[model samples]
Target: MKGLLFDLLFYAILIFACIYVLPNYVIQRTIVDGSSMADTLMDGENLYVEKLSYRFDRLDRYDIIVFYPYGRDNTEYYVKRIIGMPGETIQIIGSDIYINGEVLEEHYGKEPIADPGRAAKPITLGDDEYFVMGDNRNISKDSRDKYVGNVSRENIGGKVIFRVTPLNRFGPID
Candidate 1:
């Protein structure tokens, strides 16, 4: 009986490490805060964001990313899709997204953007910056805003790997 108890305790610690400790370095669980990423990631939806790959890799366009916009000290995070990569120019004209004068094709937006916002004019990203936007273009507070501008590569925390909540919509985030 004592041996069984020891095994249980061992397993409990291992499980705890996997659920809590390991995530600090490898992955984390975050929830969608608003309707910004709507249609793709609904408000209140849970997501498993992975940090391992991005640690030694280059981010690709269209990848969904999470970042600490208010500095790493604050806990506030924003999740958005990468629309323009480093060193590229981004602009929005009449509800269309353009990358260096080429129309960017995407299917995630909930509706046509009513406010072009700061993206009305071409904005160029530096070598270490990225332009991000939410799927719900009309209402998302993303890279278009002055404060939110192009997210620096260092501010990006991880990429969304999958959704964990609302069992009916479980699996990969894409």
Candidate 2:
């Protein structure tokens, strides 16, 4: 009877670790809720976000990340691609993105940005701040918006690593 009880306790602990500890500390599942990341991550698609990478390596530009917008609690999370990194100046002029006075060459945007939002003038990032934006430039509420300004390092939850839903589009997210 004691051996059976010990086995039961061990299994219970393992189940709890799988259900709670893993999701909270190592990796988590998140669903894209809007078209902000379209042409890359579609709305309603399931994704696996790994929390381990950023803890060890520095976040790189264009790494799609999930973060809590300033002034928001954990209840809300926004997914955006990192544009301006720490200690960088970012400006959007006439549909062109300029980083530190040079044109940023990238093909992630679905179309030309129709609105520069608060990026009409050069915005400098602090040591731990990052400027982010959505692929659907015109309609996304990203760092350009007053409410969703620069995302700090602490607010970043994790980097999106893979897409799990819609079997046809299942693969690693670039």
- Runs of candidate 2 exceeding 4 Å displacement: none
Clashes of each: 0, 0
RMSD of 2: 1.4
The lowest-lDDT stretch of 10 consecutive residues in candidate 2 is: 70-79
> lDDT (0-100) at residue 88 of candidate 1?
94
Give TM per candidate. 0.88, 0.94
Summarize candidate 2's per-residue lDDT along 28-145 as a digit string, tens digits.
Answer: 9999989998988899999999887797889999999999995346579988999999999999999999999999999999999999989999999999999999999987999899
Model 2 steric clash total: 0
- What is each predicted model's overall lDDT from 0 to 1? 0.90, 0.93
Best by lDDT: 2
